[model samples]
Target: MSSPNGASEKQSEQSEAISSRKWFARGARAAISIPAFILTAAFVGYAGLARETGLTLLETLAMTGFIWALPSVVVLTGALSSGMGIVPAGIAVALASVRLMPMTMALMPIIKVQGKTKNWQLLIASHFVAVTAWVYAMKHLPELPREARLPFFVGFGSSISTFVFVLTGIAYLLVERLPDVVAGALFLLTPVYFLCSLWGAARLNADKAAMVAGLVLGPVFFISLPGLDLLWTGLMGGTLAYLATRIWRRGLS
Candidate 1:
């Protein structure tokens, strides 16, 4: 049998554990609404748009859960629907995915455990760093404790993903039931959400400049090339913005 002191210590540990769980749950819930409203609009559009592309609900869900990047999903579905060959279509998807690299780099560091978290864990964690998650995490994670950040993010992001996943399916199913104009309006939500969020969240001159360049060039490229516009727009716009920012910083130095 344990001593009185040992029994009291065990009770204290249990109480502490319960309190930690409550604290973490509260933090996670706080993070949820950060992206919920914006992504609800965007993914509703994506779902309707995906249905138009003739992608099955399973395919839509797979893209949302596995790829988790809206722009890449748009590129892949468009290329596939256009009857592009698999290799070329894949290349286009890969090109669209390139933009996610910067988002990942900017976000994963916030929740990483350095030596404690393995490289593969970090790689898997990086997949969840999409535009919605990245923007919300960057905006809100600072208010959370270091230890609670990852769990809070996992809870918050998983809820958002699940919500969007279900909404996408529902929107896809409802697209036909709704009138044409309403469906079309739904399809436009993602870009509008992205435009507003990027501008609202941009903290640097370079970030604002890049977003403005993308905003201007995106329409031109879409008009010029139709379905393949996202690939070229991302590559060219991102490259130009990065180079221009680096040059400006160097000149300042």
Candidate 2:
């Protein structure tokens, strides 16, 4: 009979294999699910809003393709509508995208592919790097092997991009018929989805602490400081959470 340790090792190996397969499967499904459709709808709304607000179609598509961020696109559109200068619009967009920096830092270590392959992966990833894909990858990629991680992310990202392209076209064409109430409701999904997913991903102690801190601090900061609220809230909440976790761990050790 196998030793208990050997049996445990075998089980762990099997579990890892199963998890890898599941990640791959999830990558494929995410590329073609209701969630994907919802994400695509959000992008489509961005394009339609841009057109209605007098931005060119090329500019709209360029933002979707390059920025790949909804909040930034919305800020840009709103700024343009308000007769803001291109420089200020661009600054607002960049500020909104700063949230992705932390997300990328957390994800890179998990999905670090090397060599020419990594170069290609990065090229494809830039176009697909939106909120949904980021959330999905952060939650699932840790269980995946380094070799499989790139393919899984590429698949997931590509799927979202493809859907977004189609949805953007649809939104551009149907902008007139869509009611403002419906459009506003659809727009709410982006933030709701991100917040809910972020909360759900807080399985670790550090994540839970950071999330709780952010939730508590975000609104309070917003009330006190309107323009710089998100930046300050994230910094304070994340820093406090990190310090608290460190102290707790030190005490335990």
Candidate 3:
């Protein structure tokens, strides 16, 4: 009963759906990696922090699901524990999350499918542009068809985010039994994992230079300018690396 054009459209829709589902499954499987485990462990530490800050079960769960970034969650918790006002706490959390903006910017072009991918879809995908997901996407997305990249990243990010969210609730209940030192150490895992992952995955000399510069500058800034240490370290280290790499390239040329 359907016209030829209608049948072709239906068939094309079905094919697109099948491709998305297949890539989604593959992305979910890819989520079972060391970075995922490190992220989950980081959430375990967040659970303890949430409990110590007097957050209720519902609040803890909500923060885990909504904020979804350990550093931002930590900033919010720290602000609340210190009796900071809501507006200030929000600003602090936003600042902490600002680091993800560059990651999202780097990833958007990789996953975007020219005219076919919608801006709204990319917007949704940007929410999952954490360090772990960004690294995985950068490494794997090139291998996938352009159309599959967006769904694949969304699937991986959603699955990993959900997995951590559930584990955070369970960890919250068990956090009381964990030693303070152990919980703090658990929170440290993610940054260590992040640095190692970037170092290993980096393909360019500039990337390595930035890492080295950051490491060397981090402690110096922490001691001399504790309040703005992170800001200074990132700014100075990244600029230094960029200039150094450019100079080196020019000299070679």
Candidate 4:
């Protein structure tokens, strides 16, 4: 027969496990929302684009599953289609994906448990830290228990990722049936959502400043330095915003 302490510990473990499952289920259900739908729509456009770019269905699905970011997919597909070699295409994809690093960083503190959350868990969770999932987490995590946050995010992220993956295949098969205008419009939805989300979620004036600076410089750089426009825009715009913020703070003090 088990001792009373052993029984009590076993009961506690079971309760914790049940609670984790409940949170996971809640997150999966939450995946059926506007942002997730927007992500799905973006993948529809990605599917069509992939087809047009001569990628096989398998390749399209592989990219969706592995990359999981619309911008990275676009950059990789664009580079490959333009006859850029694998090395250059990979570099372009890496550059496009670098923007997500901040999102992952912002989320770490929110979901991390002081002693309970393991590094391996975080390493896995970080892979799912894309735009839609990060935005959802920011909106909902504070209301959740710290222990529940990681499971909830993994559930939400995995659910939406799978949902998009399936739809991307369907869209790929159906792209020939979709009109060019419709496909193009669908493909543009994600970036629009992305911009709106950033503006809405920005906590600091400096964040907004960087965005505005990027907007103003984007067109100018596109015309003058099309090849490295994005890189230059991000570097210059972010630097300008940082300097401005510092100057404003110094003046206030």
Query: Tens digit of lDDT per residue, candidate 2, span 1-253?
Result: 4786998888988987687567666677767866687787777667767887887767777767767778877887798789888787877777777777777777777777555255565655655566788877778777766767866887788767766876786677667646888779878988787788877766678788988898899899889986677788788999899888988988645
Give the TM-scores of the predictions, in the order they appear: 0.74, 0.80, 0.89, 0.85
Model 2: which residue pairs collide? none
Candidate 4, pairs of clashing residues: none
Better of 2 and 4 by TM-score: 4
lDDT score at residue 113, model 4, on the 0-100 scale: 93
- Candidate 3 structure quality by residue, lDDT tens digits, 26-99: 88888998889989988888888788789887898988788777777888878877999978888778767866
Off by over 4 Å in 3: 1-10, 223-228
TM-score of 4: 0.85
Number of backbone collisions per candidate, in order?
0, 0, 0, 0
lDDT of 3 at 212: 96
**Per-residue lDDT of 1-253 in model 1, one digit per residue for the tens?**
4786998889987986676577557645764574576677677777777777788889988988888888788888888789999899988888777768777777777887667656785676576678877777777777777655666666666667777788878877777555677667766776677677777777777787788788889899999986567667877887788788988888745
> Candidate 4's error at 184, in angstroms?
2.8
Task: Estimate candidate 1's RMSD in Å.
Answer: 4.8
Quote the positional error of residue 161 for candidate 3 in Å: 0.8
